[model samples]
Target chain A: MTQHTQPSAKALVPFVSVDNMMRLIHHVGLEQMLRDLAGYVEDDFKRWELFDKTPRVASHSDVGVIELMPTSDGESYGFKYVNGHPKNTSEGLQTVTAFGLLADVYTGYPVLLTEMTILTALRTAATSAMVAKYLAPKGATTMAMIGNGAQSEFQSLAMKAICGITSVRLYDKDPAATAKCAANLAGTGLNVVICTSPEQAIEGAQILTTCTADKQSATILSDNMVGAGVHINAIGGDCPGKTELAAGILSRSDVFVEFPPQTRVEGEIQQMPEDFPVTELWQVITGAKTGRSSAEQITLFDSVGFAIEDFSALRYVRDHIKGSDFFFELDMLADPDDPRDLFGMVQRAAR
Target chain B: MTQHTQPSAKALVPFVSVDNMMRLIHHVGLEQMLRDLAGYVEDDFKRWELFDKTPRVASHSDVGVIELMPTSDGESYGFKYVNGHPKNTSEGLQTVTAFGLLADVYTGYPVLLTEMTILTALRTAATSAMVAKYLAPKGATTMAMIGNGAQSEFQSLAMKAICGITSVRLYDKDPAATAKCAANLAGTGLNVVICTSPEQAIEGAQILTTCTADKQSATILSDNMVGAGVHINAIGGDCPGKTELAAGILSRSDVFVEFPPQTRVEGEIQQMPEDFPVTELWQVITGAKTGRSSAEQITLFDSVGFAIEDFSALRYVRDHIKGSDFFFELDMLADPDDPRDLFGMVQRAAR
Candidate 1:
């Protein structure tokens, strides 16, 4: 709306490039980024009722999936399009990648375009850690990390920052992935142990994390593998027909979710009934409900990654980054001396 | 996909901007762009059965409309979000502005982000003219244009190109718009006559084009003003309750629509019955059905604008524009070397 004195949010748009974001990560250590992002994600989730919500619109393909997750609060609007292709790794590609838009709701003009690939990992870990903060027992020092792949280190770092996790037992089908995770966490001050199986990883670990990327239903955590007073953070089984926990694991826990309508179809709770009683975490954060009845209660945080987390991540990036050289300046918004003269723009540009 | 050694249509994704598009316009001329785009739109319509079509998903606001119109052909996919706020003109903004995404259906990856603000104007004109090519009478020479605002010139140019319109009668509630339309058509070799009233504009004209931008159900064309053998190109009355034509005008005409389901909701036929008989223009273009039946038949092209037209415009731009350091290189797709190592990208970038 440059043509008139209309309200514009152009000044708030943060343009963070992949390289610039990489630089930002280096300047601020990975541990700090994960912890800070978790704080932001948690703070936003606590006030979740103030925001608008919607189920994601997904366009799925046999090889991959692309989705548009949009939400607004009558002030700002954000949407993320992410893709997941389990077999992309065989072709030397990342199985999940994303980009997002942050716009001003008042003007309906996009103010930011960000590479959310790295940010998604950070936010996912932060969200999991936040859930653990409320549900996990005090002095929880050891975490069982199933799927020691791309998301393993973030989980370990967040738990260490928020839940005082000083030790981690990691297990994955690919031993190389576990080895990589161990090496990455070596200087981070956490004691990492490579376990042979999910059972071995769960031994004496108070917090269990399942972040596998299998496209089909596979029980990484069964009832036998879980224990009392342990909080389960299930991450990887995010779409229909894809799940991690066994039915027995879900049947024995006080399940909690971000948005119930979507979680029922895509969360680990997809194995459960339609009338399943699950708590929206916002209520817990807002003190309207409780996260754990007691330390002995089995609390399962069904983490299917909601749109609100992305909104918070985008807000965090916009707030933390200030240098403007890394962003693309767009003429996407149409400006006429008069809004009625849109046709005049083409004519002028033609000249 | 550009990483592939062997080239395929799926491998080359084009990203065109307003600047790049203007260069295309300057090189090929607007008339040719309209003509070529019309052929492209017609060609796509002929293959209508190959498409995956749906009515646009709209998010409405008090001031304007923002929508996502998505369609696919199992190979390529496209979506566009455009807003229209007629009162936005006094603030020096265009009543309608838009941008859209073109993606690969096989990978569900966004392949292009083109400026549909300008492209929409082009496609709207082309579709109107192409429909006129099929439905307007033989040797149609004059067009009466009501509500000569943003879309007025497209109507004039399209009718001039396809239906051999040599003279146009123009009237708008606002006089400056008519002046602007007259200035844009200068030296275009068509006779442009400014009429003070809608009745004066429709005098003995073979084609009547209505492109108003009112938000109410204001009748701009009465039944008595429209006679037999007069093809009406209804361009503006798209959203609910914003129609320009009286129901009597639609009742007397054989309606041709882009998609019947959508046209029934957003076109002039919104006030009509659910069982109202209408022909999908694509069927008529493919000769699976009929267009103008006889010399006395009146045809109405209910042009609410569709996504396939944007797909065709993007395809045309992709074919015409070569990236020799004159385009926006968007990060619409992820090209990770090892898809499984998504976390490593952040780590490596941190380095």
Candidate 2:
């Protein structure tokens, strides 16, 4: 009964807390971290065909939705548990929160657990910027950052770091949100401008990113406001009945999506018909399909987040956390000395 | 930028480690905890109509399978991440490992995270015994426990605690497994009999519980071994292509199942036709259907563990952890004083 008290090393899973994740970001430097994450996202996108992909399993309620997004690349499996409650901000809670796990496919053991609320923001921005690198017009230097909420700063910084953007035009329906974003980007070396309307935000910007937090289908961008020869990163509308771009804008733009099945249901393309012509970003990354063929062609990355992005982010964190103090091990799994004697382990723990 | 260093209390989730879970089991007393867990399982089953049920999302490889089981009763949401690798035991790892999370349905915020490896074993036994109370022959006292693995001792103790079982006859193909189960039950009050064959194990027993760990269909119980009035609690055949009872035996018994959609794919009934008649255990608990209509009827509970039972176990752990130090808080969620200023929160952490 008294044989074993402590679980073996295999029982422990490395866990990255929010504070530690923030520390890791700072230790690596924010912009550099964003670049590294973008690199991982790009690498995984190149091998996208080798992975197992599924549309997120979602539980929708009147107030919000909780979703499980799982994917595996034959060697490793990853899943993210995330919740989106637009009304939660009024109650002093974040609008979205997330955590993710990576497991070994062969042993079916979780190797890493991490706080993904911050990481999701990083990955989403990284993904957008990475896609824009291929789809954006050459010599792009300015980005119109509409919907200056939690994701605004990340998108702005990622563009500056990855896409050589030197200026960001910020606008949101809520002035306070724009102000918060403006303050966060004050010393980030980007030319941050506060605009009152979406039209003013997109003026002279080569890239336009829409990232509002509304739950309904309010068009943040109309067709009349958009000009050709620009890359549009629309990330705000990520669920059914929620969209940022008008149907006219979608028709004018050649849409790019992470995954078509998921994009059709939750992305800006949800406004379009089910059979809407769209390019998969992975195909573009693999050079099987062209990203942007002409300077006057409108390219829109309909950024509904996908499971593979999270898997890539998880892999990046798992790799970076090694030989570093950014995470602590959690005694999460039960390990018995005798695999078949789990009852004996519990019985001995009593002593 | 230096305003907030630590996350707000809302961002912290209480996490129960494996050690703490074992401590909790001893604190509540093993028998009493099993009884309490069975009570919760019964209560949830009684109101199962209110729950959002889904078949587990599974990721399968050549070696093993990892599954996510999620369910919500509208007020609270729960999900368990579990893996089953039959070959893991040969490599000195557990055949199964699990962890779970419970969140608030209103805010979509996780409230509790706990190791479900041990909890799964407990809840599974509790659920079997609870159902056996209704379907097992009235005044049943002896259980024939075939396949003495990690789950055998828990099943034996749970039946003793909940169903008033007085004796257990144990048998396994491996003598070491049978010996391990017998040794773990030495101090338990039930009269334990070690049998060399499955036929000898069922001698004079009213309940037969088969819990082998094979990943394929292996008939531990045949039609000829069963008598007219005995109850079968077959819990081993819990995945695709895995069944413990012979089809002939299934044809001779009235099968009861938890979540017919799942049981049809993973339970002993996978051997039968899709249209095979089986009673939903929830309906029996809610008095919508009859259970064990007569003393001479052969009742079979094809026990493929369901999400609702895991939900009940999560609820029990959450309730019991209150006012106790059985868990520690993990900084899992991102919290900001200004919820719209998540970037500001990360920026401030740099200080």
Candidate 3:
């Protein structure tokens, strides 16, 4: 009898845990990592037509929703499993948690699996700042960060790293959240101001980022508050029945979104009629359409998040972890000595 | 600044790797575990109406396909990531590999993560045998196992444990596969016979199971090869453009399927017309429909596998790991003392 003691190397997959992800972020430097991730996001956007895009598969319940966002670029496939429960905060848990996987399209074998809660934060911010690079007003140095939550600091730093923003004004309905955001950015080289009101946060800022955590249609930015030549990065208004910006603001701004069919149901544009005109961000990134045509024109990136951004983030992580000790091999696949003898392998394990 | 070291308990999810799963199967005893898993699959089938079912989301490449199958039972959500690459065998890789996750729908937090490659085999065999228990002829004891591949032994043992089978006759196109299967089943209590031809293997057998792993359509069983009163468990004719049984066989048999919408595209019934009449297996389990009506009736279970079976398998693992040292806690989620201070959490980790 031949003894099969250990699984083959093919059974192992690289897994990046949350602790390792934080370590990798620090090792790469947060700002530089954000900048690098933004480059990947921009590159993917340029080739978005090649991706197999679909709206996220979501299972909605009364308290929250669990979603699977999957996309393939023909060579590799990636998906992120994420859950959003606004009520989790009350129970001392994160409102969102995620993990992602990347696999080889040829062999259908997973190449990487990583915790994406922190990575999602990084990618979302990078995607926002990347879009702003093509749509925000020239020489924009100030951002009005409304709803200072878990995503606020990342958004602020991403803007500073990618868009050269030097100042961030933060505001949230909860004063403690605003204070936490201010403290987190204390020595990040950016001038951080804690604002008491949303109106005050937007004062004299050329970029307005609204990322409230509410699951309802609360107007964090009214039409009157958003001035011309400012780029509105509206990410908080994701999912149905959740809109942070006013309908009039969307009516006046030249709205750009990450996939129109999805944005029509989940983004801020959901409040608009079905036939409302909006440009796909991929077109703008590819130079097929004009962006920021005039200094006084309002550009709204109605960002509801997309699968391609996660695919690019997965690609970046898979590439970065090649020569780094940032990931560990997980015995996640069953590789029998002979592919047809899975039972014999299990039976031999008892020996 | 107060120092926050280590992630909170809520941030950790229990992960059962392949080694631990093998250990778990051996600890519980293989046949007993099969019976137990069959119970869970049967229980889930009885309450099938309570489940949220959707066709698997597949990403097809020229060489293979990757899929995400997700389902929820209102309180708990489950998903399995699986891939199939038939060409992988020549490269010494398994044709299929899988992993699954179970999460709490209320809080939207994952509670269990496990390697499902082995579990999927167990669940697939258990589901087949459980359905045969209801549909196979009374006092059935012999099964002709066609396509002696990775799933053959598991199918044989599951039928022995759950359906009172005492003998298995195995045949495969590759004689080496048949030799390996016979060698694996040598010490088992059941009478195992190795046959050269599929016809010789099914002589007087009360059950027939075909599980060939080819991506293209191949007829492993013809209409004249089958007789009345035998249960046919056709499992490998899954996915589009792949099938195993002749259309004449399906035309003469009363077919039972897991999910009609899915089976129409992936099951052996894919060769059948779209409006072809077939009873759902869940209805038979719930006593809402008939199983085997007479000794001369041929019952064919068109098993393409479904998310609910994977969900039930996940539920079984979660329950079985409660007080056992079969899993390790993985720090997969980012937990901050303040849910809104994720950036602060990462920043503090640097210190």
User: Which candidate has the top score in lDDT?
Assistant: 2
lDDT of 3 by residue, A138-161 (tens): 999999999889999999999999
**Which 10 consecutive residues of model 1 chain B have the lowest summed lDDT?**
B1-10
Q: Give the per-residue lDDT of model 2 (tens digit) for B89-182.
A: 9999999999999999999999999999999999999999999999999999999999999999999999999999999999999999999999
lDDT of 2 by residue, A1-351 (tens): 222368789999999999999989888998998999999999999999999999999999999999999999999999999999999988888889999999999999999999999999999999999999999999999999998888999999999999999999999998988888999999889999999999999999999999988899998888899988999999999999999888998899898999899999999888778898999999999999999999999999999899999999999999999989889999999999999999989988987
Per-candidate RMSD, Å:
4.3, 1.7, 2.0
DockQ of each: 0.38, 0.71, 0.65
Q: Is candidate 2 or candidate 3 better by lDDT?
A: 2
Point out the higher-scoring one by lDDT: 1 or 3: 3
TM-score of model number 2: 0.99
Contacts from the true interface found in each model, as a fraction, amount to 0.44, 0.87, 0.82
Stretches of candidate 3 off by over 4 Å are A1-4, B1-5
Candidate 1 C-alpha lDDT tens digits along A31-110: 78888898888888877987878888776667767677777766767777777777766755567767777765655666
Model 2: fraction of native contacts: 0.87
Pairs clashing within candidate 3: none
lDDT of each: 0.79, 0.94, 0.93
- At residue A300, candidate 1 shows an lDDT of 92
Ranking by DockQ: 2, 3, 1
**Local error of candidate 1 at residue A162 (angstroms):** 3.4
